[model samples]
Target: MDGEPVDARWGSARVRGRRLRTVRAHAFAAAGLLLAGCASMPDSGEIRAVQASQGVDSQVRVFGVPPADKATPAEIVDGFLEAMTSDDPQLETARKYLTPAAAKSWKPSSAVTVLSSGLSRVAVRGEKDPEGPRWKVTGKKLATVDEHSAYQPQTGAREYEEQLQLVQDEDKQWRISTPPSGLVLSESDFQRIYMPVNKYYFAGGTLVADPVYVRQRTDPDSRMDPTTQTVQSLLAGPSRWLAPVVESSFPTGTELRTGTKSLSYDGQNTLRVPLNDKVGNIAQPQCKKMATQLLYTVKDLTGSRLDQVELLRSSDDKTSSLCSVTSVSADAIANRPKIPEFQYFVDNEKRLVRMKLDVSSEDQQTRTEPVPGPLATVPVFKVSSAAVSHDERRAAVVSEDGHGLYVVSLVGGGPMPAQVPIGRGGKAETLTAPSWDASGDLWVADRDPQHPGLWRVPGGTGTPERVQVAGLDNRRIVSLKASADGARIALLLEQDANSRILYIGRVERPDAKGDVSAVSVRELRPAAPQMADVTAMSWAPRGRLLVVGREKGGVQQARYMLADGSMVAASLPGATGLSEVAVAAAEDESKPKPVVAYSEDGIVWLPPGAQWRTVAAGGRSPVYPG
Candidate 1:
């Protein structure tokens, strides 16, 4: 798989070549080529240049003209595995190879994009050999580190045999052939290597094909196939593929659990976990996993809900369990303790390593209550809606005061969040809705005399921009907040006295096009017919939004997850807190990213941690099905 293409590339250039079976075993050969366009060439001469010198050696050259030439195929194989399972995938490795064209065509999608999966070993079949002799190389899936998608699996691997078809075009430079025929491959076969979709990254024989993962006919947990091809993910586990740390912070007394698999890390990190009952000294209330969910986080890892931990009932299952987390997880350390979150840290050996604590009041409580003090008359700004940015670097808060939005910096080590003014700037307006873009840009709905429209503020500090509305005038609507990624905005559009329509719009661009015309509804939330009206509304991670109301459906707030009109929205798995939610959003976009909330407790609430994303993303979080 590695050299076959290179040989063909050289062949296309009309270069006669002999296949060498090895590369050096010492230099730690790292091979990665993120080329996007093999189809573009101005002339034959340009193609010929590649043929002149591009060919992999079969044996370890250890010292050659190029760097990868000196590394062994084994080293290359092990290295990728090491990176995926250990040091973590660094996007820059492939970022270095993004051709100008490739970068131009790049469209950010909800799914993680892998730049390239390469191989070593330079084997080639003779002119006449059965099955064209195997082309082998090590492979690993490279992905963007999204805390929300930490639960999503890296579906690629290394150190495997592949069926390759090296296309020798007229030019002599080997070019990867065009895409394969869909109908030619069986549905079952396609899912394994080709696919009804490309989730596995197997191109299927034109370039290369291999069994990346398989359903075992016998053991459910362990597969009798190549470990490299094992889909340890769909089964359940952190991206690290072992018992991973769920989060670096957690709500106090929250339980934590691991998956049912043997976990280890980096070839050296091991866990001495107990399969019989619980792990001793490794956690609070030692010897615990027999009953409670394990809540833990190491002191060195600053993980957010994107970081995670896995549980193993036994060391044999492909996957045991996974936990959600809420601290920036690189090293275990103290996290921003504004809201309640839970985290757990464990090793590949299924042993617990560290734990962190998060805190929040009960679901029924509101305002965290005034502690019987003389400051009771002062209005307590309770959290109405909340959203954590992609990196967990900051949290967006919407409260009941005129200070429309606030950014809770997870890194700055602050007690009280720094506030941003959103209202008329002079009066005490109830600042109650906030959201964020992936880059930590702040979007808040400021409600008061003059500042009654949706506003935008970047995290680094700058002027706020007004989100334009088409049909409705500025002062007519109370508040409007954008979706988590800032692709859409949810607004409480005014109709008359008793009713208001909540609209989410596809914002063209806040800086250039003040396009207020792109509004559509994932679902239209109704205001109460009795008592009063809709005060504030928010779109949670999924298509679910919490609206403060006074009517029947308003008082006893019912949470609804609206699928992007095109699909079906799932109601949150088990949401309890309901004092008053001004806003909410999907934790992330990968696995079942939860509906995070700024609870009635004046603090925010999130899923357990790490296992936040879900495959059922609405693409436009809570965006209308346009």
Candidate 2:
């Protein structure tokens, strides 16, 4: 029977006398008989054993209950708030707690206010209203999901307060007269109802992943499932934070064909998307790009394999063929990072060294060897920290004194190249570790007290240009990591002894005919505001950061977080006491490389589903290819 209310009038009816009591007893007897007829325990059967659930039940679904008769004003307000968190497809049950006019005007999908816990509802003692009683609902806001499905987290726990008025209906039953416009849910409820999905867009020639949230099932207001809703959000362009750096291939007004409500895969494991006439006349190349974006965005939504995505355009009330892209063709358009052959680090001898990746067995003691280039044969200064290029052909090394930066070749033998002068003259411990973006450009930060700034070297071989960081109020960038897509950068900054913050900024450049000198960092938003201290971080696959830090009044640990500032269900199982950590930026994330870190035990490697094991006894600054 799916366990829903068959009839609720029995609870709302007003009746009296012994005859009504007898009717209630008869109704209860009839229900017992109906349930008994379905199944009965075999009292004399032989005993048998069955397996019990091994873990907590995750598939439990919540249903809303109707209000009791003669409910008080506070009860009405509290019931409405509880009903908002239930998974009602159309939210009709939640509307039952509201007045007719208020129900009609309330739009739950307008926005979502997420709190750390359930809201507190209390009666206003001295309020005087002619037609209703007043109650207050308040919470500490943690985040908000906008109408566009973008998840934005707030730094501080801001106060959120609203008033709910209760009035009597024609039958004199209490109901909420005024209701909030959007859904106010606790953090646990929000996680259960919504899921995180990525939409693809172009940043210059590379594809970037923009993370957003969508309802887990059919949306209450839109009536569209998660796949269709994600595609619609993709056509609406990137989020406001990412709109400045990325562009969508879809046309300005392009949308799903009219009256489309759901999207599914065909027998060939292919998805065919129908678009409106606005994109009917696009070229094959442009159409392919659009299909590629859709293929990546919705590939993981369903259990079935998504091998290809074909676009169908409407013309004269008839659908015609547009271009299509397969999984193979999409890779050419998306510039994902290449798999690295080895993980690099600074050894006890202060030289750049490497060890083979994907170690197949526990008994396999892979030997560590020096790199094949000048950094191995003709070293000039002691190496403190380093970053390998995405292609694994070159490495950027910082001097042990932390005042010089040099780019060294790892594949070809040559003399050690001259240090890239970043103009941080004569200052000790001024230069941070160097990082390489997917476009082959190098980035570094100078924390010199006199000239604190960020510098980018064009092509890793050109003059360094100091980039201006917006919204950095008297803070110095201490460490930095540019994303493999070259569209975003993560920075660890400090303002004083007590102020340490981690921020992710959008990398912007002017359209002055490919002028690389005009590049600057803009819109530095907090990436890990929940933590009080962030010691180390590196760019991980799928546009995430592998962070090492601790929350306020907590101990240090390592965890992974999305670049959009949303939490995920991922963290190092027992990786503690880590001073630094690194993750490989590979294209295929299904089989990730081992996490490399440096701790009190020296260089440690954490293979998937295994405890951390020491590799080198005296190594510091372990790193992977960007």
lDDT of every model, 2 decimals: 0.32, 0.76
Q: How far is candidate 1 from the true structure (C-alpha RMSD, Å)?
A: 22.1
Instruction: Kindly provide the TM-score of model 2 when superposed on the true structure, using C-alpha atoms.
Output: 0.86
- Tens digit of lDDT per residue, candidate 1, span 485-547? 344456666566665555544444423124344322222222222224455555543223445
* Worst 10-residue lDDT window, candidate 2: 10-19
- When summed lDDT is taken over every stretch of 10 residues in candidate 1, the lowest stretch is 202-211
Q: Please give each candidate's TM-score.
A: 0.32, 0.86
RMSD in Å for all candidates: 22.1, 7.9
- CA RMSD (A), model 2: 7.9
Clashes of each: 108, 0
Provide the lDDT at 598 for model 1.
33
Top candidate on TM-score is: 2
Total clashes in model 2, counting residue pairs 3 or more apart in sequence or in different chains? 0
